[model samples]
Target chain A: MSGRVDIIGLGPGAEDLRCPRAAGALAQATDLVGYVPYLERVAEDSGQRIHGSDNREEIQRARLALDLAIQGRRVAVVSSGDGGVFGMAAAVFEAMEQGDPRWRALEVAVHPGVSAVLAAAARLGAPFGNDFCVLSLSDNLKPWGVILNRLEAAACAGFAMAFYNPISKARPWQLGEALARLRRHLPGSVPVIFARAVSRPEEHVEITTLADARPEQADMRTLVMVGNAETRLIPRPGGEPWVYTPRRVGMNA
Target chain B: MSGRVDIIGLGPGAEDLRCPRAAGALAQATDLVGYVPYLERVAEDSGQRIHGSDNREEIQRARLALDLAIQGRRVAVVSSGDGGVFGMAAAVFEAMEQGDPRWRALEVAVHPGVSAVLAAAARLGAPFGNDFCVLSLSDNLKPWGVILNRLEAAACAGFAMAFYNPISKARPWQLGEALARLRRHLPGSVPVIFARAVSRPEEHVEITTLADARPEQADMRTLVMVGNAETRLIPRPGGEPWVYTPRRVGMNA
Candidate 1:
């Protein structure tokens, strides 16, 4: 059998939200590899040999998948959101570039999926309506200074921003620092959304303003989105607020 | 019968790339409103009434969908990519906010689809594997100054960037100007991807570097991606090159 690797996204927490193309990759795979939580979401009846690893073991997991593919096994490397964004796709490529040159000859495909950014944005209306930037707040991969700089730049540019891995047990203050940096350049009334476990039963969405946005509102599972200067909110009589950023820039802007 | 509006994305192009949820929305839609090209892609035998409009008529198209929804018809406002990202979802919300107060009462749901950004990135091997910013180079909605400022900010901040609507017949020089701005902040060898009509039969993806990137490479249908400083490329013996931004940033970055 020809060896191949499919980097697939599970898409937030819902099965239906997963792209049909990604589902096809999983169906054809002989081995599955991802974080325990993501791998658990796949059906046991698929009969694919599964290898579940920790979230921090991305490179190792990628290596395992690459090795399996090199051995002529159909391997599917899974991620919770779009694999290309801070997910397995990068790790697999990194491994291929740094590890075995032979791995480059193996067939590889990255199947796009509905990302957490899209999933959260869909659940909370169209807050990401216009131009936006996405950043990961964890300093483990980069530095605190780099994250803060990007946050400030995005805020100053009046771009809607989505933050991933905003808060974790080891790095709790980064989210606060990010919000504070944005507050320096933006007004207090700018809208902020904290979407946790999106599309899942335990999903929670918190919509507030910059002045009211707290670090406690976000956790590792939370995807935080801060709207641009012109983001607007429409209050409903008996439901959650609807929020969106207008597509057009203001006259002065 | 109560009317509703489903703002759905058709994905980049392919039928299978379209989200199943979005397909369901189209199937349930009694009235469809979108640009002519997108509207033409929907199946004709679905029995849905189609309202095809001009490319620049987003607001008017949104208004028509809202009016149909208010008149107790299921309306689907279709966009080629995820509607939340520079698509019809914002226009629908903007129209609802400005046109009729009753529109606030109408049921509106935004169904997320695989965006062109994701689709293009997947085809090109995770060039967006790290944090990135997305901007529209078209200055029609926003001023040229704003687009230039964003281009500078994104390039300076070391974010991988995606440019939507990079070039049009009338505004041909913007892409070149945008590339020139990036050339200042990014190295000469930084990878740039020009992905056109992704997932379509005529789709083409050109992988080049900042030094060789040209304005004429892109058109209206193309999505351009510029990798961050740390992005890497893996060359195959007999295939197209693979590109990805490493998950970890440099010490200085």
Candidate 2:
């Protein structure tokens, strides 16, 4: 009896943002595996065996989920945002490729969700209305120089950017350095948004300009977005301004 | 008695993929506004007054929704994917910025949804599991030279890319030209994905190499994804291979 493994995204910490397909997969799951916080988002009454692991143990967690599925268990691996974006979906595929050969026989599927970048962009109007790039600033898996190089390339290309894992205790200085480098390629007036825990109760979104943006404004929970050269802001009477990038780009621009 | 406008995403072509928050907004809407095809995605029984227009009439649609909302009608403007990403949200903000001053007083919100890129990536394993860029190949809104320049920058930066509006009747040659240019910077072995109408009944996903990809393989309904150098395919016995970009990038890479 072969079972299936479903990798699902919980969608930016909001229960309402979770799609029906993902919820259905969660309800039918015989076992749940994920980081402890994401696993806690699941209802406690489902009575599924939960395998919670540290945030850094993605490979181990993926292997465990695959092993369970190989043993005829319906397993679901969860991520906070879209699992396809810097999440467990890749790790599971990696494990299936390099680990137990039986893992390949078990059915595996990925369910998409509203990624943190989309969620944050929604809250900020439409800063990503045009072409954009999504990058993770965490250098734990890659070299820091590679991150800076990509940042410069995207910035010079005039693409809006969404950054994940922007700042943490281990890498507090990287964000500042990134911003410093961006200032050379982009105008100081370009809009930058720091959105934290979007769609959750503690959600806070701050819109600022590149000239005034500080590294301390963002934390590990934050998703940062920097606009392209054409990004604009529409002022409201008494509330924060709405930010958006116009759909059209001039021939010379 | 002022009513608000909610721009919501329908999430590709699947009802099951639509989030509860968007559904709730649809249920409460007194009026709906969208392009004709997306409006058809709504249940016929919703009984809301829908203002469906041509696909190119985004600004006019945004103005109409704002006008209805300003007249104390709860309006919901729908898009097939995330409203913030090349959808009605930017158009609405643009209209509000330049059309009517009363639009500034009316409450406007953008609800996030699973975008076409994310949905396509999910259906094909995790091709966007690492840093990636999203671009539109349509030159209707931007200059063709700008598109090619951005493509080159992203390719040189080693980003996996997702392309929207890859091919249409008016611009049949752009995709082929874009691929030819990419051949200059990227290896011919890079995997390219053509996912057409993902999550719908007639969904078809094709995986090919950069060397073998043809312009005829895609249409307006297709979302194209090209992997970075490190993207790998793991073959299954009787099924198509799983495509994923590992989370790690080496120092030299």
Candidate 3:
């Protein structure tokens, strides 16, 4: 029988944020395959064969994991956040759909970890406590039109919005354009959070209003959140501000 | 100095799925408080006082945890799934926003967990591998019209959607109306997944087309995912079907 394949999430850059299931899979794996940064997360002395590949080589890395599993090796494919969220899980399935027929017969399980969306929300209180939408602003994979449509829809619906891959060196204006679209529907006072390097030592969270939010404030490492109309900021005398979205809509209070 | 209050998630009903950060908080907690089902997840011999309250008592529970923390007891506020998403974190913030001024001076931290959205996505092979929206169909807090508007907006945006609190005995027809609304914007053939009790022993995942899906198929325990227009199903010879939303949108295949 072929050995099992476990696709695991390392969570969003924190050791303790990693779930036990993912950690156990890493400890038990005969081989580990992932992007370079995620691969660095595992201990070097674990005695497991590690294959670190370039970023965006998900399909190739997935195929490598599958081949190793077919040879009766316990293989773990690692992704930074939850493997299923624009991560290795979809790439593995895509490879399996188009790769060797035997790959389909192999055992596969995906162990989810804390996603960056959750990590950012946790750091900034409960900005995602109500209805919300998550979008990737980079147009590298999807058309700009598609991203714009989703942004407009989310903005019009007044859903709290989380943007992953908000800004990068290659696509700097996407965030500005997205915000411009949002500003068309949402009030200028809507709060926006720029949660950078969440849970890591260099973590920084900035709370700003939509009108004051600048695109340059976000980078590839940052996760940006735009509050719904109902979201609020509660000030503290001695600490950072807390942001939260109340559960109700259209209630007279 | 008053003790700290940590609002932590237990993840989606699995011990291993729980994040280590939350586990650490639980280990140090002088008191653990949450909804009855989640509070029961903790081991009885853990030496911490457990306060289990009836559902809908989130504010009361938050107050209790705060009161405990103010008394110099390290308190952990537990929630199933990520606490920031429709969970205890918001309630705690609400309590702190409206409660004692001394509560604002207490230390607080939110440990992210493996949410049901991620857990269900993992079990069903990455239905949320792209842009998506998460909405609660329960109209007890929000107006039904708000839910319908957001559902229509999400559907119109062509986003894969995860619906929490999809259906309950008190409001069974909401899911049907929701599905009917999605059918109007999306193709009848769009895929929908019902992930019930994900990551637990009673876990079950059902993949069905939107046209064939019925409201009765889901319950309060289910996390329902309605895939984007591009979501696909790959049939396997030896296992259940794999569902995935391709990473790209508006791509020529």
Candidate 4:
């Protein structure tokens, strides 16, 4: 039988949120490759060869998956959220472009999943109801200045924003700095959502504004969303106020 | 029993791409409401009262769903992709905020799905591997000037972009104008993907350069993706070349 590599997303921490196609891919795999925590999310009795590695070793993992697939192994590379969005799909393609020439001939397919931003936005009312931009606040892959420039551009353009990798052990100051920069472009009353461990048992969502948001509230597991000027906060009877950006932008806006 | 409304996404166009949570919501719904095409995608013999309307009647549909839920009906309002992203979720919240006061008390939930951009990117080897922005080309709700301003800002910020509603019978010239504007900031060699009805039987993905992309190549169902300067194209043996944007950006970029 010919080998193939299927890159699949497990969704954001919930079994029900994952696509059935991704689940089917897992069942058909001879090898499973991903970060340790993501690998642990799979069923233990899948009977596939499990290769779990550190989070920082994406390139190495991609190469290993490709090498295994070339050897006629049905490999499945997994990521926590949609593999196409800041996940393993890009790394696998990057590896194919830079690694062994035969790797390009291997059959590779990426299956979509419920992305982190979409899951976080669903928990909150619909902060991404209108046009929006998604950025990673982690400056490890890109420069700090680039992130700031993109933040100012998206904010000034009046687009709501979703941020991944907002805070980590090594980069705690960036989220605060990003919020400070956003305050310069957006109103103090504009809502900011801090969604941590969304869709999991430990899920927590907090709503604040640009003027009062703190970086300490978020960790690597958190996804942050900031609304545009037209975003509204509707007070409900007994729960958190629903937040959403209107679909229509008035002429004056 | 108290009433509730569940706004769920049907995903791009495939049954397998829809989340199990969304499927669960649909199964539990007593009334299904959405645009005619989206509502038709559900099982016809599900025994639920189906309320289908024209595509332009979003606010009316949302209000109807709210009214039904207020009468103690289990309502499911469906959108094509993730309901939070330019879908029915925002319209539902808007109706609640502006309509009946009791609507605020009704339990409402938004379930995430495979969004159009994510599904399109997955089909084309992760074109949105890095920071990206999603914009709608239709100017029906927002002014054309605002859309242009956003296009310029996102392009200058070096973001990969996904455009929804690129071409409709009412708005044909806007996409051409938008592409011309993008050409001013992005190099002609930048890859542009026109993905029509992604994940469906009629799915067609065309990869072209900014200089070669035409507005006529898209339709109401197409999702357009424009890569940043760093996006690359890798040639394989007998099929379309793989396209992706690298996760890392050099300091010079």
Name the top DockQ candidate: 4
Q: In terms of TM-score, how similar is model 4 to the real structure?
A: 0.98
Query: Candidate 2 regions off by >4 Å?
Result: A251-253, B251-253
Scored against the native two-chain complex, candidate 4 gets a DockQ of 0.89
lDDT of 2 by residue, B1-253 (tens): 5789999998988888999999999889999999998888895855689789997899899999999998999999999889987789999998998888989989888989999999999999999989999999999999999999999999999899999999999899999999999999999999999999999999999999999999999998899999998899999889999999999897542
Candidate 4: the clashing residue pairs are none
- The per-model lDDT (C-alpha) reads 0.90, 0.92, 0.89, 0.93
User: Model 1, range A147-172, lDDT digits (tens) per residue?
Assistant: 88888888898899999999999998
Ten-residue stretch with the least lDDT total in model 4 chain A: A244-253
Worst 10 residues of 3 chain B by lDDT: B38-47
User: Cα deviation of A47 in candidate 1 (Å)?
Assistant: 1.8
Each candidate structure's count of clashing pairs: 0, 0, 0, 0
Full candidate order by DockQ, most accurate first: 4, 2, 3, 1
Candidate 1 clashing pairs, residues 3+ apart or interchain: none
lDDT of 4 by residue, A1-253 (tens): 3889999999998999999999999889999999998999895765789999998799999999999998999999999889998899999999999999999988999999999999999999989989999999999899999999999999999999999999888997999999999999999999999999899999999999988999988899999999999999999999999999999998542
What is the CA-based DockQ of model 3? 0.84
Distance from true location, Cα of A64 in model 1, Å: 0.5
Query: Per-residue lDDT for B1-253 in model 4, tens only?
Result: 4779999988998889999999999999999999998988895766899999998799999999999999999999999989987789999999999999999999999999899999999999989999999998889899999999999999999999999999898897999999999999999999999999999999998999999999989999999999999999999999899999999987542
lDDT of 2: 0.92
Pairs in steric clash, model 3: none
